[model samples]
Structure formats: structure tokens, C-alpha cells
Target: MNTAKQRKASLPERGFAWAAAFLLALFLVASLFSLLAVQVMTSAGLHTGTATNDSVLDGQMKIIHNYIGVLADAYGFEAETVRQSVSRDELRDFNLNAAAWWTGVLAEGESRTIPRWYSPAMEQAIRNAVDSAGTGEDPNVILAEITEKIDRTVYPLRESLLTTGLDFVNKRADIPGIVRSLRQVPPLCLVLCILAAGLIALLAAREVFSSLKYYGTALAGAGLVLAAAGIIYAVMQLKAMLSQASANLADEFGTMMHTLFLEAGGAAAVLLLAGFACLFIYRNRFEKHMAPGEEQAA
Candidate 1:
């Protein structure tokens, strides 16, 4: 059995060294985890956006094509009027009118009378090809022909209805652009970086204080300084991370912002608990200030 003096001599002075080393390891793990998680989230968002955009653009093209077909059928114009061989100027005008109709939906509201000239131009062009028919008789025949064509073209109308089912794609587009456009660092990474940096700083402060230790008072003072510096570093980094998160929240995945906040808040709570544990170890192990007489009585 060893005497008190012998036992004391056997113990090394590196008392919180292992604990500090463990925290450093944890900090590194956390940093890597944050980096990987952000990469996964960002990649998923971009991939989803790409697939959704392709589907939406294809669906929109089909709807526009079907709508033009319906317009041609109703007017009973020559097939060439709507065919791809039409003059660029005429096609541009047609597209402008269609775009005007769509844009007007947001302003003048739906059910605006389509300009009379647009229908008559196509009707006159088709009617002029035939001769010797009564004026109203040709238009009546054209109207009946249009109705029959519509009844037969059920597939186009069905395909056009796909747009209504695809409203979700447009909503998804708004967010991915924001995510891609803003190439800032993720808040989680910044927070982890600050955490790792603070942990390293704490380890350094502990080493510095141990080297300067003239007495237990100096060692205790150094531990308190390390803990305080760690807390300050954590707070500053946390604030920067929060600011970045807030900017990202204004994004379309603003819904995801709530989720991110919950995750970050939970991480913060865990760190806070760990900080308190560090302080408890520091106070109990290093800062006991019992008087010499009290120590003798014990």
C-alpha cells in the first residue's frame, strides 16, 4: 500500500486532458457530419428540381400544342394556317395574342372577349378558297364541322388537363433557384466550425494555464478563463449561424426552415448541457478553496 505522499506523486498533473481530447474528437465528428448532411440536402433539392422542371416544361408544351389545335379546329381554317410552315411574322403575332390572353388573365380577369379580327381573319381565308356558297351557309357548315372535330378530338382535351395536375411543379421551381443562386456557406457548417475552433481554443487555454501554473489558484483561474472563452466563442458562432439560417428561411422551402430551426435548436441544447458539464468538472476538480484549518479538521 502506498502512503498519501506516494499516491499523490504517482498521479500525473494532466487531469482534464483526456476529457478535453474526447471533446476535440467529438468536435471533429460533428464538423464532418454537418458537411455531409448539407451536401446531401443540397443535392437532393437540385435533383428534384431538375426532374420536376423537365416534366413541367414537357407538359406545358403539350398543353400549348393541344390548345392551338383546338383553336384551329374551331375556326375551320386551312390546316396550313396552324402548320409549322406558317410565316414567322404570323406565328409571332399568334403567339403574342395567346400570351396576351394569358397575361390578361391576371389583370382583366377571365372571359375577356377575344378580338373579333383574329377569328374573322382565319374564317375569311378558309371561306375565300370556296366559291358559289351562300354567306351564312358556309359559316354554319364551318361551325358544325368545328363541333364535330372537337367531339372527335377527346384525347387532346384529356392531355391538356395534365397541366391542372402539374401545378405543384411551378411551386417547386421558386425555391431551387434561390438555393442555387445563393452560394453562401450553410449555417450548420459554420456552427460546427465555430464549435471545433472553440474546443481547440479551450484545449490551448488549458495548456497555457497549466504551463503558467504557480499554484492551484492560477490553475483554477486558467480553467475558468478557458470555459468563459469557450462560451463566448460559441455564442458568437451561434449568432452568425442564426443569421444565415434566417436569410435562407425567406426561401420557398421556408417550410423546411422550421425544420432546420428545430434541428439547430436541438443541437444547441445538447451543446449547452455539455458546456454545463465542463463547468461542473472545472469547479469541482480545480477551484475548491477550503481553508488549511478546515482541511485538517476534515
Candidate 2:
């Protein structure tokens, strides 16, 4: 009669324990994925890699040269002469600076005007061309005209090249607020996961080995799901799914996605290993300490 009453009481506790374990699994997966996302989104190295991609920089320089060609045709200046003024090295330095500035903006939500290094370089090139050609006109007057044209034409192109498409989203949504919420998600999920874990332990207080089994099951379940997802994503070709309007953009997005999945996979592996270790300890060590009948029941 006493054993029957004990079993009856344990039924409710076991039910609660199962529920907590399920919640723990769910929260574990959520926290892991959210943490990976936050890290990828705010990674400076990733941003800089995208910014300094060879194809992207090459494309920007090509457009700039094309604009200079148009200006040369209109103002009777040599296109090559102006193009030669800004060396590839100078353009590379400008991009490096721009990447640093963009990284800061993403992190701090502080805005700064992008420097117009190209404008000065192009303007001086035009002035040199006029002087070399012996145009007999005041170089300053010609410089002013070309400078105005550069402001109207090349400046917009420069802005487009250097931008990471955030401005478009910022205009439509509260990006800073969204980022703040994203930053908070992982820690919030972690706290809830801990609470669930604690609840499971409390519910199974009299059955310590049972709590270990529950924890092992929860962690293993979550790890398996996360790992499978990460592997699937890593193998999938994301570039085809992304907007092909800009090849450079697609490449960068793919790179970021790759990093995210790799981290997820790594985290999942750790969780899976830990879960298995717990289960192994419970089976080998804890079960041996139980009475023959209790061990058989377990």
C-alpha cells in the first residue's frame, strides 16, 4: 500500500519533469541559434571581408572610371589622365576606412559622414589635365565646373558602392531597436533555459538519477536537431536563393551564412558530446549503486 501511494505521487512529479525537459530542449535550441545569429550579424571581420571583397572593389572602380570617361567626353579632359590620378592603392585605403566606419555604425548606431576622398582626387586630376593641355583658361574655373559635375554624378555612385544595404532597411524599419532586441534574445533564452532546468531538477529531487536522465535526453534531443539543421544549411547553395541583382552582395551573404552554420554546428557538437557524457555517467556509475531490483526497473 505504501509503495502504491509513492508511485501514485511520483506520477504527477514525473509528468512535470517531462514538461520541463521538453521546455529545456526547446530553449536550448533557441538560445544556440539566436546566439550564433547575433554573433554573425555583429562580426566586424565578416563585415570587413564583405566590404573589401576583390570583386566588389573592382566593380566600384570600374563604375568610377566609366563616370570619369563620361566627364572627359563632356569637358574635353583626358579620361585616362583622371583615372590614373587615383591609384588602386588609394582606392583600397579608402575602402578599408569605409569598412571600419561601417562596422562602428553597426555596433554603436552612431552615424558619420562617409569621407569623399574620390572627389578631391578627381578634381585635382581634372585641374592637372587642363594645365597640361595649355587650355589658357583659368584652371580654377574649369576645376569648379568639373567639381560640380563630380558632386552630381560620381558622389551618388560612391555612396552606392560603399553602402551595405542597411540604409534601405533603416529607412523602412527601426533597425537599431531590432538590433537591440536581437542582442538580448540569446541571454533571455539562456535564463529561461536555466529556469526550466532548475524546475526539472526540483520536480525530480528524490530521483537524482532520473533528473540526470531527463537532462541528458533534453540536451541530446536539442543537439541532434540543431546539428542536423546546421549540416543541411551548410550543404545548401544559398546564392541561388539570394537576390542576384548584385553578384558581390550574393557572395557576401553566402559567406555570412556559411559562418553562421559553422558556428551552429560547432555548438551543437559540444552539446551532443556533453549530453552523451551525462547519460554514460548515469548508466555506468549511478545505476551500479542502485539495488538489484531498482537497477532492473531503471
Candidate 3:
């Protein structure tokens, strides 16, 4: 150890330094919250193209497709056969409507009608086709009857369903707002953190080494707290929220919430590690810069 001692800081100067440190701590805390919020929003609400795979939305979509198939079968139509006839554009429209149904459940106090995918006339015609499918009816005649019925009736019904679904999709996600929020929050957090650090540095210019340990310890403590909270929240969300709900839309919402909570928890853990690292670095090496009693001596 170099037996070197620095002169003490004035009482006013010491108070100002500690005050600046406190402000810095607050800024760091804000930064942590903002970072986690951004992740949660992006994961749950933004619905990026790549994020769609295996997401709650994807799961919800499967449920929707199954529902449509079931509805068609209830009306005596071959659901799989009909679905096979759907074009890419029609399929896209149907998906949008299904997603709309999913979105309503996620919003609190939001009531929306579940779409009836087929008209009564369409159902009746399909039943008629099913009834006349066999029973010694001329083979070509029966086939012709069924084909004509579907071309005139079934395809029209499908187009209407597609139109309805497209309308729902148009209403669901607010793209511009989501993009704006994502962009704004992180930069704001960064600015606050930088300003805080600068304030601390300015106040502690004379005792730079001594103040660093305090800063590191604050970071470590905040990070650990956030990490622990995040872990607990993640566990609770997985157990209580991730399970599929009785309704298809509710199940999709559960998935969305689960993913968001998980991401938030991860962010907290990263913040915690960063804080601990800061504490370790200062405690082990930078603490030596203070000489342990600079302010007291002055």
C-alpha cells in the first residue's frame, strides 16, 4: 500500500457529492425500469414478424383455424376440403379476423362480438349437399350438384368471412404508436443515466476514487433487487398466466402476458449482474484511491 493521504473536502463539498450520488442512483433505477418496459412492450404488443413463431399469437391462430374447421363441420361441410380450397389472400383475411377475436380478450373491459364464419344460407346449402351426397343418385349428377353449390354458395360465404377478418386486422395493432414508444423510452433512459453520471462526477471531482465505490455499490444493490423481483415475477407469471384459458382468445392473452413477464425478468437479471460487477470492481481496486479519510482530515 502506498502510504499516501489526500487532504479533506469541506463539509459543503462532501454534502454535495453525496447528494449527487443519490440522484445518480435514482436515475439508474429509472433507466432499469425503462429498459425492462421497452422489452416487455416489444415482446408482447409489437408482434414483429420473426417473433410470431411459437408466440402466444401463433398458438391463438392455430386455435382459430381449428375453430373455423369445427364450425364448417357442424354445418355438414368437409372442413379440411374447404380449407384446402382457400387462396393465400383469403387465408390471410381469415387469420386477421381470428386475431381480432384474440385481441379483444386481452384488453380489459373490451367487449367484441365473435365472428360467425358462415351464413345460415351457406350452412343450409352445405347440409343439402351432404344429404344428397349418395343414395344411388347418378354419380356425375351428384358431383355436378355439389360443385355448382360450392362455387355459387360456399365461395361467396368464404369471401364474406375474409372481408370481415380483414376489417378486424385493420383495427388491432397500432403500429405507429408502438414504434414511437419503443424508440422514445430507451433514449430517454439513456439521457437520464448519462446526466446522472455527469452530475456525480462533477461533485466528486476532488475525490473521484473515493466516490466510485459508492456508485458501484449502489448499482449492484439496485441490480440485485431488480433481478430478484424479476425472477419472482417470472415464476408467478409462468405458473399463473401461461396456462391456456377456457376461451381461445383468453388463452392467447395468457401467452402474451407470459412472454412479456419473462422478458422483463431477464432484463432485471442483466441489470443485477451489471450492478454487482460495478460493486466488485470498485471494492477490489478503486477503493484504494480514497486513502480512507480524505474528507475527515480536511
Identify the leading candidate in terms of TM-score: 2
What are the per-residue Cα lDDT tens digits for candidate 3 across 1-298? 4344656567887777667656666666677677655554443343322224244335434554465466554444455543344343343444455444434432221334654333333345444545554333333342344344323221222444644655575478654445556657767866876776676677667756656655665566556666666666657765344244334334444555565556656765666676666667756663454465753463
RMSD in order of candidates: 18.8, 6.8, 9.7
State which candidate has the highest lDDT. 2
Q: Where in model 2 is the C-alpha error above 4 Å?
A: 1-9, 52-92, 104-112, 115-175, 231-237, 290-298
**Candidate 3 Cα outliers beyond 4 Å, as residue runs:** 8-16, 35-45, 49-51, 55-58, 65-69, 83-186, 228-266, 286-298
Which ranges in model 1 have alpha carbons more than 4 Å from their true place? 1-36, 39-251, 285-298
- As for candidate 2, its clashing pairs are none
Please give each candidate's TM-score.
0.25, 0.64, 0.54
Estimate every model's Cα lDDT from 0 to 1: 0.39, 0.70, 0.51
lDDT of 2 by residue, 83-193 (tens): 777566666666667667666666655455765455577667778887776656566665665444433322323444434465766778787887777889999999999
The true-versus-predicted C-alpha distance at residue 276 of model 2, in Å, is 1.6
| lDDT of candidate 2 at residue 120, scale 0 to 100 | 70
